[model samples]
Every structure is written in structure tokens, then in C-alpha cells.
Target chain A: MPNLYQEVIFWALFAITVFSALLVVGQRDMFRSALALIVTFLAIAGIFAQMNAEFLAVAQVLIYVGAVSVLVIFAVMFTKDMPHSTRSTNLQPVSIVVVGLLFIALSWAIFQSQWNEMPAELPVFVESTLVDSSSQLGTAIIRDYVMAFETVGVLLLAAVVGALALVRDK
Target chain B: MLERYLLLSVILFCIGLYGALSRRNIIAVLICTELMLNGVNVALVAFSRYSTPAFMRLTSVDASDSVKVLDGQAFAIFVVVVAAAEVALGLALVIALIRSRNTTDVTEINLMGN
Candidate 1:
């Protein structure tokens, strides 16, 4: 029961995500690249919504777009001429070869793996009671992944403390 | 549908890898890593959506059927949180490097004298 409207929207978001990712990598201007990355984050968040991940969509927007990208930009400001960041670097040729080979190898392995099949009853999850938002997710977090969740929070706190300690005037 | 999402994920991942490897700017590399993390995240969430038995049996009235519903999504959230922590620390390191070395270029940050 997929409609043309949904397909169009999906493709549009897909294009935005891919295009902005390319921009994030290829653009020399750091601020421009950060903006492109924000676009990519927003597009991916839209894709999450398209896939019926309402909670994740919101989290993606809040964390990636709102928090991470802004942090990147602020960090960019700490360096002068960082916006215009000239010089592509000497590693690019080696990087191209490495990344291309990795892509080929990964694609081959994935294609070889027979786990590409979706469930027979394929959940489009439009009206399912399991809208599966933050409530269920919170339950799962505090239940199944409780340790990981708490560890991550602790890790974030440590990172904050370590950063302050590291950047202090000596 | 799953294939398409995974394909997109692979492409996104490779692009991030390229960026991380090719960019001399430490900030660019950090951003690229975020891109790569997002790529993994898409795959996880897509699996949670389309491949999980919970989603398949979503309409079942059994109470336990909802337990592992979006484990992938939960894992993705964890990844996102960790990535944020990583970026914070990484950027701090970059700032510290700039303060010490007076440059943002990765090639120039040589601590060990050769």
C-alpha cells in the first residue's frame, strides 16, 4: 500500500542526505561543510520518520542537528581561518585508494551475506499500537541496555570533565 | 527496502571514511566520524523497523511481544550518545593541540621528535 507521495518524499530526503554528505566531505570551507552536515542530519532524521521511528527521528534532530553540529561550528570558531581552511592535504590520494577498496570489499561481503531478507510480514508500522516511541524505548533502555545507558552517561560526564581539564591554561 | 537502506548506509560510510582519511583538518575528520556513525545508525534503525519479529508480530496482544521491539533503535541511541561524547572529547583534543602546536593540521601535530 505504498503511495507515490511517500516514495517521492523518501527519495527527496535520500537525495538530500547523500548530497549534503558529499558536500560535507568535498567542501573546503569548514563552516559550509558544517552546514552541509546539518542538512545531512536533518534529512536522515526525516528518513527516520519515514521509517516510522518517531522517537529516533526526534532524537536525531535534537542531538545531531541541534547539539552536535552546533558544537562542531563553535569548535570551528576556536580556530582562525578555519572557515576558509585552505589546503586539501597530502593523504588524499592514499585515502581515495583505501576508501575505494573498502567500499568494494564491504559491498562484496554484504552482497555475499544472505541476511538481506526482510520479515515476511514486513512492518510498515503505520497504526500499530507499538508506535514504539520513547516509552517502550525507555523501558528497554532501563531494562535490557541499562548498563550501556548508564555507562554512556558516565562517559559523557567524564568527557566533559576531561575536556575542561585538558584545555585549561597551563 | 532493507537493501536500499543498507546500500545508502554503505555509501554514507564510505564517504565518511574518505573524508576522515583525506582531510588534514582535525575538525573535518571529527565531522566525518560523525557521518560514519550516522551511517551505522541508519542500518540499525532500518533493521529495527523492517527486520524485527516484534515489528512483524506488532499486532499480537501478548505482553511479552513488546519486549525486544526496537532493540536496534535503542542501540542506535546509545551509539548516538557515545558519538556525541566522542566528538566532544575529540574536539577538545583538537583545541588543545592547536593551543600547543599552533596549528589544526593533523600532519603537523608531531609530539614525538623524529
Candidate 2:
């Protein structure tokens, strides 16, 4: 039942995301790795679009591909010494084993779990509402989740202050 | 559909985890963390889109509909906001590390007063 268009896009996004993530880990140059990270983020955003989460896709592009990628590039700019020290032991074999184990465990859980069809009286298929998520999201932030919303604002404020204090001359 | 999305999310998370753990550079680690967070966001949004109750879907016409739960989008927004803050603070720390040691290796900066 898979449409060719969706399948094509999904597989393309998946390939780019995984490949760029590998680039992020394997590239000797930190700047090139940072650029690869941007590709990964953008591909993930495309996946978000394929999922029909329009608002989230936009936010992913704006916040992640735009802001976070820029911040990471600046960090890479500051830390240019990573490429020089090509230590033989820079890679960890244990991490690969651990990640493989985690992937197996997660796949098992995903298959065994009944998340797609919960026992509760949930819809068989959630109607994709790509048109109204932004309005709905804005409303949720203001009405039901207002307290958490304010807390996030305060957290950002504190983060700014903390960053300044950390960088200040001692 | 849900399974496909979840599978991608899980794989993305594992890749990010490996990158964070195996890579020596702190910046690579940071990028990996961002990738992991994006994976989590994907899962959250997928759940939100796929898990709505039938009654909520039918009855929720207005933006103020309490029956409808846009919790996933809300959580994703919070994650994005917090991640921005985290990157800001994290880069500052990275800069400090660079200034102090002139290096970006995670193994070199031991603050244990050795």
C-alpha cells in the first residue's frame, strides 16, 4: 500500500540523514563535520514534513537548521584543534557495540508494543491536520500549558545570564 | 506508518548516541546530541499525530478545545526552546575550554584538580 512518491522521499531522507550523521562522526575536519550535521538536520526536517507535521517541520528548519547549526559552526570555529590530533584511539569500539545493542532492544520494543493500536478508545487513524497545527499550538501554549510556557521563558532568560557569566573575565 | 517512523527515530537515536560517545571532539558530541533530540522530537510528533482519541478529533473544532491534546507539538516546542538555550550555554563552555586549554578533546579537560 505504499505510494512510490512517499517511499522515495522517505528513503531518500533516511539515507541522507544516516549518511550525514556518519559523516558527523567520522570526518576528521570539525568544520566539515559541522556542515554535515546541518545536512542531517535538514533531512530530518524533511522527514517531519513527510509525517505531515507541518508546523514542526517549519520549526525544525528555523530553529534547528538555522539557529542550532549556526551555533554549532561557531563552536567548531572556536575549537579548531580537533583535526590536528588524529590519535589512533580517537574511536571507541564499545560505543558501536552499545549502539547496536540499543538498536536491537528498541526494535524489539517497537515490534512487541501495541502503540499503533492502543487498547483505549483512540482513533484507528489520526486524521492528518496539517493545516491547523500552528493555530492549535499557539492556543495550547497560551491556555492549557501557560505555566510551563512561562517557565520556558524564564529558563531562556537564565540561560542567557549563565552564558554571560561563564564567559566573563574572572 | 507509525512503525516506520519509530524505526527511523530509533536508528537516528542510536547513530547520535554512538557519535556522542565515540567521537573525541566535544563539538561532534554536541552535534550528535542535537541529532538525538531531533529523533525524540520526531517520535513525539508521530505519537501526537497518530494517537488522538476519536471523540477528541470529532469534537475539537475551536482552538480552545480542551478535548484535543496537542501535547506532542507543545513538548516539541519546549524541546526546541530548551535546545537553543542548551547550545548557547554549551558553546560558551566550549569556548572557555578552548581558551583555557587550546584543545577540544574530551579526554584532556579534567577539572578534578589533578
Candidate 3:
């Protein structure tokens, strides 16, 4: 009962994810690689959308694609001579073979695992009811996971202060 | 369909890992790390959908009603926030290194004295 549009979107995202990943590794210019990483992030967001995690999809776009990618690009800009290097090369052949073997083993394990399907009793429109996901998440963080939430906040604050210190003139 | 998505995610992740481990340039390594993060995000959502009650019934597979989908989504959000923080810290370190060494190449930063 899968819809045609879902299939099309899935394939499109698959192509984009693979292509952008290739560009990320294959491109010589650091800036171009960053751009490809952005596209890869966006395509992953699309995949999140297809998985019905609407909130995550939007967050992925706003956070990773918008914020993190821009930060990396700016870092590239600040370190100007990085793009002039001619040393784009793959890892050693033995390592490549090891990685390939690891990938095959992992994929095989994934395929062999008997995954449980969705429960039948859950509501169909949970996405609609959960539209205020951020608020719900906030409540959970504050009530049950308050310590973890505060820790993350402090970590972000430390990161901002540290970044400023690093960039500031002595 | 799920298999295809999983395959793509795995490939992208491996490429990213290769780049992170092999590349000499810091920017290239960062880009690869981002790629690996995205791969994890994809897997999380995919598994979430797979475990959802509605999706299970759609595929006509009997699953326990106690399973919740929100956990995966919440974890993904946590990862995104952490990734943002990590990039901030990482870029700061990279900038500081560049300023001191006047270079960004990983191989050139051999100040540890072999």
C-alpha cells in the first residue's frame, strides 16, 4: 500500500544522499566540499520528513544545514590557505579493505536482525497531536531530564565563550 | 524500501569515516564527521518508523503496544543539539591551532615530538 509519491521521494533522497557524499569526499576544494555537505544534510532532512518525523526534519534543516554547516564554512573562510593544498587522497588500500569488510558485516547484521513492527493500538495521527513536539520535549527535559538539559545548556554556553576567546585578538 | 534507505545511509557513513580518518585537512575531516552524523540521523528515523504502531499494522506485523516512537525522535533532537555544540567547539580549536601553527594540515602538526 505504499504510495507512488513516497517511492519517488525516497529514491530522490537516496540519490541526493549518495551524490552529495561522493562530492564531499571527492571534491578538491574545501568550500565545494562544505557546500556538498549542506546538500547532504538537506537530503537527510528530506529522509526525516519521509519517515514522518516532521519536527526532526525541520530541526535538521534549521540546526545542521543552517547553523552547523555555516559554522564550518566560516571556519574554512578564516583559514584561507586550506583550499590551495593538492593532497586529496584516499586512505591506504588495506584500511579501505578493512572498512569495506566492516561495512559488509554491519549490513549483514542489520539484515539478520528480526525487527519488531509498529504496534497496532497506537493512534494514526500522533504526528498531529504531537505538533508541539518542542514543547513536549521541553517538558520532558525540565521534569525528568532536567540535569541533562542544564548540562547541555552549560555546554553550549561554554562553547560560545570558548569560541569568542579563541577568535578574539590577544 | 527500507533496505534501500539503509544501504544509502551506510555507504554515506563509510565514506565519511574514511574521509575523517584519512584526510590531512581539518575542514575535510569536519565535513566527513558531519556526513557520519547525518547517517546516524537517518538510521534513527528509519528505526522509529519501523517501530511505530501504525507502520507495524500497515505491514501486517504484530508488535507490542508498549513501544513508543517519541524516544527516537527525542534522541535525534539531542544529537542535533550536541552536534551544534561540537561544531562550535571544534571550529574554535581549529582556529586556535591555525593561529598558532600557521597551518591546518594534520600531518604538519607534529609538535608531539616523536
Candidate 4:
């Protein structure tokens, strides 16, 4: 069983994440939606920490909050216009029904499934003082997942080039 | 605890789905997609923490005998990398769309659909 502080913090982060994610989807102002997205990302990072993924939590803050949200806010600024109350499509009702159904089915599956979980006493990487989690992650990337690592690097380079090409003046 | 995290993931994913399907603004669509990715990331990390075995450090005469598995977190890192690259390119495309069409509304920019 998790400690009391862990449960409290987890619930708090969960509420914040869900609320801000809703704001991101529902806000009328695009700028405010982007801001709410930032909040959602931050809260998710906190949840990552609760899951004992400190490295992922840091990367979440740096990549999602730092880079992605900043880029999105810049896009919002570039496309700013007169505020409109309506941002939803004519398909809003249909989308709501579909998403609601999806949510129900997923939650049902989650509750019904029997996952093969590790023993409760198994130490999470960050909690184990004997080994460095980040270093282990790095070694796995270089040694075990070197092909995937190189592929991701190439993918990023291609994305960068493609984006520049797309945005350059005609 | 696993169920709680999974439930949270589904909720966020569903909300993002609704937004992506219903939002008229293209940037809003992009933002919703990011939310979906984050939802997946949460599930990934939760499983990583709860489902996977603990880190085992084996010592042999050759140090290369040691084995470490952080597969879920590594996959999550790749997901983050892909998401970052995708968002960069996506925002660039949004900017270019704004430059050419002068509007960010997806409904108004349906030039390709017959």
C-alpha cells in the first residue's frame, strides 16, 4: 500500500490533470486552451513522478511543457483573431457520444482484466539506491535499443527538415 | 493503483478524442492530440512501474553479463521524442496554413474535399 502522502498527492494530481485537460478541449479562447494544455502537461509530469518514473517526469516537463507547449502558444499567437464563442464542429454531439462510449468500454476492460503485476516489494528504479536509473536507461538505449535510438534520431532530423521546408517562403 | 492510473488514462484519452473530433480550430486539434499522447504516456509509465520486474544487476567475471530492462520507460522516452518532433512539424504546418489561407478554422479550409 502506498503511503498517505502518496495517495493524497496522486489524487490531487489526477484531478488537476483531468480538469486542465478538459479546459484544453473546452476553452473558448485558443490562447487559454494552450495555457490549460500546459497545466495538463505539468500535472501529468507529477503523476509520472508518483509512478516512480523520475526521468520521465523530468523529460515530460522539459519536452512537453518546455518545448511543445511553447511552440503551440506561438502558433496560437500567430493565428490570433477575433474571439469567437463557438469552437466546436457540428459533430460535437456525435463526438461526445462516441467518446463517452469509448470511455465506458475502456474502463470496463481495465477493471475486468487481470494484469500480471510484479510483487509489491519490487523496488522501482528510482527508489533503488544501488543502481542509477538514468544511467541504466542510457545504457539500454545505447546497447540494447541502439537501432531504435538511431531511428528516432533520424526521424527527428527528417521532421525538422520537413517542417522548415513546409514553412519557408514561396 | 494500476486501475486508478489506467482509469485516468482512459478519461484523458476520451476527452482528447472528443476534442480532436469536434474542435473546428486546427491548433486546438493539435493540442488535443498532444493530450491523447500524454494519456498514453501515463498508462505506459504506470505499467512500467507496477507491472515490470525490478532492476536486476548481475555480476559476472565479464561486466557485460549484467542485464537491465527499462523497456516501458524507454518506450515512453521514444514516445516523447516522436511527439515533440510531430508537434514541431504540426505547428509549422499550422503556421504555413495561416500564411496561405489566413484562417485557422478547419471547416473553412476544406480545399481538398470534394
Clashing pairs in 2: none
Question: For residues A1-170, what per-residue lDDT tens digits would candidate 1 score against the true structure?
Answer: 56899989988998899999999999988889999999999999998888777888999999999999888999888785543346767888988999899889888876776763555554444235246566877888898889998898899899999989988888
Interface RMSD of 1: 2.5
Better model by TM-score, 1 or 3?
A: 1
Model 4 residue A144 CA deviation in Å? 1.2
Q: What are the TM-scores, per candidate, against the unseen true structure?
A: 0.89, 0.87, 0.85, 0.91
The collision pairs in model 1 are: none
Say which prediction, candidate 1 or candidate 3, comes out ahead on DockQ.
1
Q: What CAPRI-style quality would you assign to candidate 3?
A: acceptable
- How much is the lDDT of residue A155 in candidate 1? 91
Question: Over the stretch A1-170, how does candidate 3's per-residue lDDT look in tens digits?
Answer: 57898888888988988998989888877889899898988989888877767778888889988898889889888887543465744454655777789799879977776666544443544543245555555555566566777888888898899888887889
Evaluate all candidate structures by whole-model CA lDDT and list the values in order: 0.83, 0.78, 0.75, 0.83
Q: Tens digits of per-residue lDDT for model 2 on A90-157?
A: 45788888899999999999888876443343332223234566776787788878999999999999
lDDT of 2 by residue, B14-67 (tens): 888988887777777788898888888888877776654344545445533532
Better of 1 and 2 by lDDT: 1
How would you encode candidate 4's per-residue C-alpha lDDT over A47-77 as one tens digit per residue?
Answer: 9877767788899999989999889988888
Q: What is the lDDT, from 0 to 100, of the residue B108 in candidate 4?
A: 83
Each model's backbone clash number: 0, 0, 4, 0
